[model samples]
Target: MQHSIPPGGRVSGFRLAKLLGEWRRRGARHGSADLAAAVRMLVLDGRLPAGTRLPAEREMAEALPVSRTMVSAALDQLRAEGLVASRRGAGTWISLPSGGALVGGADTPLVGSSMVDFARAAPPAIPGLLPAFDAVRARLPEQLVDHGYYEHGVPELRRRIAQRFEARGLPTSPDQILVTSGAQHALALVLRMLTGPGDRVLVEQPSYPNALDAIKAMSAIPVPVAMTDTGWDLPGIAAALRQAAPRMAYVVPDFHNPTAHRMDAETRAGLADLARRARTPLVVDETIVELDLDGDPLDGPPPVASYADDLVVTLGSASKSHWAGLRIGWIRASTEVVHRLVSSRTALDLGSAVLDQMVLAELLTEPESGLADRRRHLAGQRDVLMAGLREHLPQWRFDRPGGGLSVWCELDAPVSTRIAVVAQNHGMRLAPGARFGAHGGFERWLRLPFVLPPDVLREAVRRLGLVAAAVSGGGSVPHQEVEVPVA
Candidate 1:
């Protein structure tokens, strides 16, 4: 089974530290108040779920750039607010306010410890991944002499990625590629390099939440263009570009997240034309392109770079196609843009892990068969999930996504958040549609990922059915409340 954090489980201190990204600046005070505010926000927003253990004071101080005194003070503040608890032998864990007034409604159920988490959209590693490591191990000795720090990535990996793009009709040179930790990191580099605070950035209405977060983190204003149930609103996007003239427009053209709507070739060309005229760089995310299960013998849609190579910057990842643990993703852009990213990358990290890049290179050199195998697996899982939703929860309407990991499902009532709240109480975790919508749209929808195995998907759907029923019943079900003892 894929690893998931149980509702009352504790994630590693390192993981918690990462979740507290750039939190020091949120409050005017750089010490305890700011740290406390950040932790409180995380707990309230459900990112740091209740019952997750916070790192020890010293550990947190080491993980973040704060003193142990500040960490202790922050914990004290959280304790006073009932957002944290401590046991004699146990470390501090997150807690919701008593009565759940700050988070959900007072009657809202505390999420059970046995909840089946559906928040992650990643799939398990493919079968060949283990053996691929041995392939890389054999070549490790050949490169031991060098210092092993490569900001532009291992040259061989860059060449292989370029060839992969070339095969897809987007001719690319190795210099055009800059490998990063993952797609999110690539996006961060792009956002930092291309846009500044107060600059307008265009994004899909219900786009990737992390992408929106990244834009917000940079303090760039996001101009959303609505993407309907059918597909991209071309005219609407055109209008946004014309009016906003955004510094950058980010789009997931192939197998978009939440909504698995792929932009047609004509629409891709139109977007390219528009971006070209506006002199705006189009950031096309192709992380899910290889996931197409439309039953076509051909490969997925051509890269947006093919539409206008000069105007479009493309992001691709081995995470979606092969495995996420590898942490290998790249940016394919103009050589000039690549140079800028390379120069600015040291501010983020020196480079990606070299060994992971080598493994991805091997995978890329011979990926068609492995890709076909994965597609078959995902297709089977998708079908099983769809069948379960149909049989168990027919009222939850969804489009059969042609490609990508999740299906954007619509509900009759605008209670997606309420359903998620209730589902959390009933041992199921859900990514509410409101999480995807920037302006509180998609309130009637949910993004259900079918990447899990058939049996697991069926059981998850069954649990979700219980939540759906409780939601549709229009009566308050008494929730079993877990009272957390304050620190």
Candidate 2:
């Protein structure tokens, strides 16, 4: 019954150190200034968010492997700048200089106006969406006569969504579906059903930030398994399953976020077998499954739920494939699990928006048909963003994402947070690498979404290159595309 997130989350020393990556430059001099700048970056980036308690100086110093004097000096500098507020007993927490959020704050230069939002990796509605809505409107009068509450979602939508699974070579029944507001909402319900406070949940090392926050919100611990060069670390996951005995494992095997790694059918089978042996529920998120930029998503690997019918719970969303504005997503589990989810869902909300559900039903009535234009559109944007990245910020290295909306870039320097903070002032917002980490690591990584128009993407990356140069203390990048070699 208690659902409110605690007043604030207390970030530990080790986690704080990980958040502040290779904060100090090559030369160790001016440690205080460097540390202050790193903390300032985290605060401004909203990674260290307001009301997040900072660890003690001694603990932070030990974790940062720096002198206590340096830590004190750094905090003093931050306090002087009005970016931090502290008391003898209350300790320190993040605070804006002008007592407002960085975003839309009067004194802050971030996202003031005409800002290009690179943080959100989603696209506009498809052309077919308007027609879908028109189709729904023709039938809205009939639906309005009903009770207007579907704890298990509208029947038409459930059937349409279920048929999508069948097209992907995974048999699904409408009775096995439970629709919700979105995938994030679906995940929240799953967490409520499967986990309790203090229970451990297995997750990818650099997993989705929102998912990580969800786990922590439940007071459950996240047991992370680092991803390998190729894909999932099977042996490492197996070890964690044995050691941690987590309640459930949440993963995005289909075009994973941030890294954009797709799991082959073989890996899916391996993961299913592992979950079977450990008796852990495999919660698979297939949000961006239909965004296969290279080939047909239908012809790709089978749904993860097909590998272990009874043990797997699949989450799907039209937000990525179609449009987030639809606000329609669902859960595909066994009949019993679906019933249980619906039973628990009443505590949250009665159902999703009826009109949006009807529109999605109309869109998915011809499943792959509506998604083709979306894929083609995203592919063009992906190519443009990739080309712009190579031309403008060649010091960064990133693999071509087979699918998904973003490019997972590995910067030459561990300045992802620094670059993100600087980018805010450049009329572009960025999510730093550390935000994806369970304990705030991944300093060399940053996820750049290619969801903007080709022209907008070009301008955004142009500004990004400048931000990178400024952070590295280099000269301004030329407006003309110049490919620099990445060592």
| Estimated TM-score for each candidate | 0.74, 0.75
- Which residue pairs does candidate 1 place in steric collision? none
List RMSD in Å for every model shown.
Answer: 14.9, 20.2
Judging by lDDT against the true structure, name the best candidate: 2
On a 0 to 1 TM-score scale, where does candidate 2 land against the true structure?
A: 0.75
* Model 1 regions more than 4 Å off: 1-114, 296-298, 477-487
Compared with the true structure, all predictions reach lDDT values of 0.77, 0.82
* Candidate 1 RMSD to the correct structure: 14.9
**Tens-place lDDT digits, model 1, residues 74-185:** 8999889989876666567776665541121112222335445576677656645645777899999988988889999999999998988888777799999999898989
List the candidate 2 regions with Cα displacement exceeding 4 Å. Answer: 1-112, 474-487
Candidate 2: residue 256 lDDT (0-100) = 93
Candidate 2 lDDT over residue span 54-78, tens digit each: 8889999999999999999999999
